[model samples]
Target: MPIDDFDLAIAPLKDLGGQRVWSLMISLFGDLARQEGQIIGGPVLSAIMSAMDVRPEAARVALHRLRKDKWIASEKHGRISHHSLTPEGRAQSQAASGRIYATPDDLPEHWLMVVTDDAETGPLEKAGFTTLMPRLYVGDASLPVPKDAATLPGQAVPDWMKRQLEPASLAESYAQLSDALHHVARDLAGADTLTPLQIATLRCLIVHNWRRLALKHPALPRPLIRDDWAGLVAHQRVAALLAAYPRPDLPEIATA
Candidate 1:
């Protein structure tokens, strides 16, 4: 309950908007507790969520929602509560891990186009295609293109198209996250060890923020991605910081 450098380190991410409590908890669980037999005690959850500026009432509401939605299961042990993802939830989290944690170098290198009517765009878009124009969608070439597939000649994206894809707001958000992470690295410098709560809180905030931005668009090819894209830098910072603060097993956190 006492404050330390982590108090300063977590301030920037605290006031950021668009953070849904349930989704943020999902991000936390996905990062550290998605494995079988993993469970987080109420005290650990409170510590991590408090550090992230989540209120107790809101946290309880999120737990209720997760339970009702069958995304998580909670247990009562004497006067304390413990939580873990349901089998369904763990499977969903596992499915997204590769995309969420992939290195920038491992991003897709080729892309293709699919021409579909408005009615058919829903399924393709859900599959990670970007709507470049009406009836035209662009996505990773590795995916099986539909019947109306079109080859991307030279795999080049024009200046106008690049502008359409990478908006100023998106760049700014990534830049902000990248800056915040730099500050965290600065604050935690010379730290030889950190409590499990500290590590979980940092990982949750970083991953939650990054996932919101990274999953906003498909993993487009290098040619399609802008040279000055802030996401590129932010992605590197996320990977590096996550490595530096390796996630602890659930037992360490449950008893912290």
Candidate 2:
């Protein structure tokens, strides 16, 4: 069936969290308008937020917060305000995009482990290690590893270690997001063609939630990841859906 009201179709996504306005705005800008010179005009931004059921005043306040935080810069051309990521903000967004849009194919083949020391902890953490406990770190073998460390190669992780990597709360969140994503995929599959604004809003909501989960997930080998890991399933679904609803240009969305 066609989606008569976009909000109802995406209720699972909207209800996934508290819908922090500023954070949602960040995801909106990051997903839709983070490129250099890309601008999301006030009306287009407003339309997307409104379609997602965000209140006008809440969006305004979130914009204000982004401006204050130096994550976004705005210009007033006539009565409309156009916003784009700041240089620093753009760089930050770009860094995050690596994770947010990464595919399941990027999962590492072998995981490297290090029994890190106090000083080594900082470097290991920087190198993307998941600390199972004090001075115990595991990360992708593809990334740089430090000297003076006895590293081990692992094809699979034990339940005890997996518990540390995939905490109960994180797994639950992933499962919930996965269910919501399947809902969206089904909804979009049968729905009528979406407007630029509608497409942008839906993409942002999915990316926002995926970003939250993906960023927190430990970088690990394919074998280390659970066979039924919801996060992995969610990752696949997100990738497919994003491909299905390709991003629209800023101008197209703004003019719509």
Candidate 3:
């Protein structure tokens, strides 16, 4: 009955690739094992995954894929397997961490804009600059400018730029995730205590989904965003739920 209710509460998450075992595992490492030489045992990984209804075989396959892709590396010590992020993997995870963990308060009010020649737009876009106009891009104040461009402080944002901030699909996706979190929080209230494994599973689901949506949208101020932006609501809800269900200790989850 508990699992059923849990499943229903988080049903909306499934549509957002919540069951992607490999991706979820990558997210798990990014959240808990990105530190230098941090390794998670195979059993510990399985224990937490079981909470999310992932099968052992699926986890193994995902690990295999991750290793093949250089996202993770594993060593077997006397039949006990330990896994850690590869250097490349850690780099990717660290790059994403800032966006994933940033609170609304972390965003700066002012931004930096770079206007470059049309031929140079490729490099700017690849470097995470959001397109504001042809050959015009905007990013956080700290964004570095290439030698050819002149950096200017962000001033008034035109309506056209605001409309371009978030595409319809991305806005809708964040709204759906926000709404799902709301449902889960309300449903789980006063429920029986969840095992450590169960809590870890739910936490992973919440973080993985939230991170994708949060990271996709650039960190910009409220005035730069549409008034009806769902990202703001999503971030608030995610923070609240994470506070309510804190991360369990690695040992507790692994043993459970």
Q: How many backbone clashes can be found in candidate 2?
A: 0
In candidate 3 the C-alpha lDDT for residue 222 amounts to 53
Question: Which of the two candidates, 1 or 2, achieves a greater TM-score against the reference?
Answer: 2
Model 1 CA lDDT for position 13 = 69
Candidate 2 ranges with C-alpha deviation above 4 Å? 1-3, 119-122, 156-164
Could you tell which candidate, 1 or 3, scores higher by TM-score? 1
lDDT per residue as tens, model 2, 25-93: 889889988889888888898888887888999998998988999999999999988889999889999
- Best prediction by lDDT: 2
Which residue pairs show backbone clashes in model 1? none
RMSD (CA, Å), each prediction: 2.6, 2.1, 2.7
Q: Which stretches of candidate 1 lie over 4 Å from their true place?
A: 115-120, 153-160, 167-169
For candidate 1, write residues 1-256 as lDDT tens digits.
2356668767776655568999999999999888998888888888888888889999999999999999999999999998999999999999888878987778788777777645466777778877787778777777776765655643667878866766456878888888888778877876657887788898998889988888776766666777666787788888998899899877787677
Root-mean-square deviation of candidate 2: 2.1
Q: Per TM-score, what order, best first?
A: 2, 1, 3
Give the poorly placed runs of model 3, Cα more than 4 Å off: 1-4, 156-160
lDDT computed for candidate 3: 0.78
